[model samples]
Target: MSDDRSPSTPPAAEALTRCDALVLGAGQAGGPLARALTDAGRRVVLVEATHVGGTCVNEGCTPTKTMIASARVAHLARRAGEYGVHAGKVHVDFPAVQARKDEVVAQFRSGNEQGLTEAGVEVVMGRARFTGPHAVQVALPDGTHRAFEAPLVFINTGARPTWPDLPGLQDVDALDSTGLLGLKERPEKLLILGGGPVALEFAQAFARFGSDVTVLERGERLLEREDEDVAAALTEALTADGVTVLCGHQALEARRAEGGLSLRVRGPKGEKTLHGTHLLVAVGRTPNTDDLGLDAAGVEVDDHGHICVNDDLLTGVDGVYALGDVRGGPAYTHAAYDDYRIVRDALLHGTHRSWRDRLVPYTVFTDPELARIGLDEQGAHEQERPARVYTLPMSKVARATETGETRGLIRAVVEASTDRLLGATVLGAGGGELLSVLQVALHGGLTAADLREGIFSHPTWSEALNNLFMQDPVEVPGAQERNDPR
Candidate 1:
């Protein structure tokens, strides 16, 4: 399973190989799917152009979160005096942080490849293109082509970073998420272009690492998918961390300026030019289906190149399925893993549920982390659903007071009819963990009343949940003015 894709001379002719399953892109889903297919008594061939563990391991979550952890340590070190503990001046070794991230990624990726090898799954390192329905041609880095045809084909090619269409974009070198992680030296000032999870996470992390960071969000507000309160609190948190946030800003052009790169942007204020040492385009990602020749395989893709699939993850083609981020849903690793589970159950057990039933919990790796599951207050109102909202600032949480990390809020949405949990958002320290507690409650169909009466350990973040449900639900939007604050 040790694949080296170094370029070499091309082979004379291509040869075709037949297998029971041909999975494209050894990403979160494809990696496990290949192994499980082999275990199910089907021969599997996994084609990956790069690392086995996809973006999470190679570029996305693993590397970024690892660096975020280092950034967190640096942040805490600077804030040590808040706890009545004196600390010396802190300095960050950027290379050392990068090394640790690289090490963890290597371990995870190597383990993925090793598992595939042990499971008897053949691994091919190359670019895959569908030659026909249930058939693919892979061009290896050595200028050689290998072909695979299988009754069962899975598309898990994932995605790549896409830069916005701005003038002079190509003329100046701009870093995508992958390129940002590969920086040998931290930029004196980092200009981030986007307001999504990816953009904000890096914005906070790099700023904590002592870089001058500014985030330009085209939307009128950051985290457009979130409620105004949640987004505003995050904005305040980042501002307190010394990161400048400009909302309603559109980059009109990019160009080379003295000492580095420059962006000509139009904001709510007016047209202005900003200079920075590096530019990171974190606007969005495009699925890798562009060159996959999906048309040859009768697979359909959305306007954004995301493969469209049904609840069963089938692409409306016989024996072909699409999963993970490529399938056009929540682009989280857990969702991708569940996709493998769904597909595996259909393939093996012949029993599966609608994909819509799954819960997608996500966390922004920012300080006083932001975590969410199910719906939010705004979403419930948008659907005109009968739901009640409850909110508690982190300052009220006992553990938060004890830890001196109270710069966020906790919010919950409950079904007014059922009294059961509809969704929740936590924007404080250990927010992700808090989200997990709510996730279990939502999964168990526990009512907010149940949580309100539920006893929890004192002076703990989990205990804050008990207090979260103590307050009366905010008046339904449009009923009257509400007192709930972010």
Candidate 2:
């Protein structure tokens, strides 16, 4: 099917304003697309439904990480006893923490707004709906509406938290990630309803903030998408921090309880009920594809409401593309950023940047952060390639021991016989930063020998990588030619 869908019958000026490029959703993807297009001397109009910097800067990463930092401080004060420091009666000001988070968000929000202005990109604050493949009608902040036309339309409308269809779930007054951020009062007892990154992160955060936290995961283990060891470490860390984790429990229903909320769950132990002062659901996200009129534009979305995009980020609709959470791959801030590069390159230079080849890394911003990139062991095995798993405990790293945070691991999955770096997972302090090196290794076509030969500074968190590769190896067929160690 042809992607371009500009209507042959044109309307008056009220219909559309022509531009070289029109971008939808001004978060990470839209903002960067606008700047790149503008820099390339193309007339660009950037439309945003809500704030700039998308969810990462506004809601997801920025605010959440800011909250995580507060939790870390609270945790440190509580742990001061081990260092011979008697920090008696520690108290956390929830209002102050929220205030600080707001301050940080506002400062960055203004900077993002200023950047777009400085770049001379037209920023339209409104909700945009597709009129045709290349036509859009936007509802402005005021009651009035405006329309625009372009040869190319890029959709980057980010995703939002989804409420699962559980019985009595709608009756209870609860919070999602977005709603949790707006909470003024600290919950006395909080019940988290998922075991993914967001759920576990919030669980640990609230626990450190003095809330009795309980996490309910439908899977047999936490972070079901991650490797088993990574999940186990996270579960142990959360349990140690006073957060009760209940895995393999399916939340059947939720209801209002005596001054709290109760969730009925079913598992091997049969039916069980969990009670808490507040309920926070971090199950997953739903892409904001609805009401955009994708059907009107001839773009296709899956059952989960994700836009069907190609490897080059092209949607079913011609001259229109989708990226980020809507594209149905990894939903990360940097993934969205990389999508911006792909779309911009295709638009400006006629170059094709395939996201498939690039190594996408993900990190959970918990106390002992968890980061992973490339393929896991199960992925490698499914691909029918012999994979080797290597791991080094965080306690073996001098820096981690010195920091008194030695309770995680660095794992690598190598393409056996070839010794090429396939994937790496780091779960501990600085895991986010450490994952970048692995991304480089994967993208740069480096081997395990390269990692081993590299000079990582002494007594550093990064040095864990060198030791991680020193673990056991696996055998892959036809890998002798590529087995030369660096």
lDDT top scorer? 1
Worst ten in a row by lDDT for model 2:
3-12
- The alpha-carbon deviation from the true structure for residue 302 of candidate 2, after best TM-score superposition, in angstroms, is 1.8
Clashes of each: 0, 3
Cα RMSD, model 1: 4.8
Best by TM-score: 1
Tell me the whole-model lDDT of each prediction, alpha carbons only: 0.89, 0.86
Mark the regions of model 2 whose C-alpha exceeds 4 Å error after superposition.
1-15, 473-486
The number of residue pairs in model 1 that clash at the backbone is: 0
Kindly list the per-residue Cα lDDT of model 1 for residues 281-381, writing each as its tens digit.
99988888888888878888888888888888998798999999887788899999999999999989999776887778999888879999988988887
Worst 10 residues of 1 by lDDT: 3-12
Off by over 4 Å in 1: 1-12, 477-486
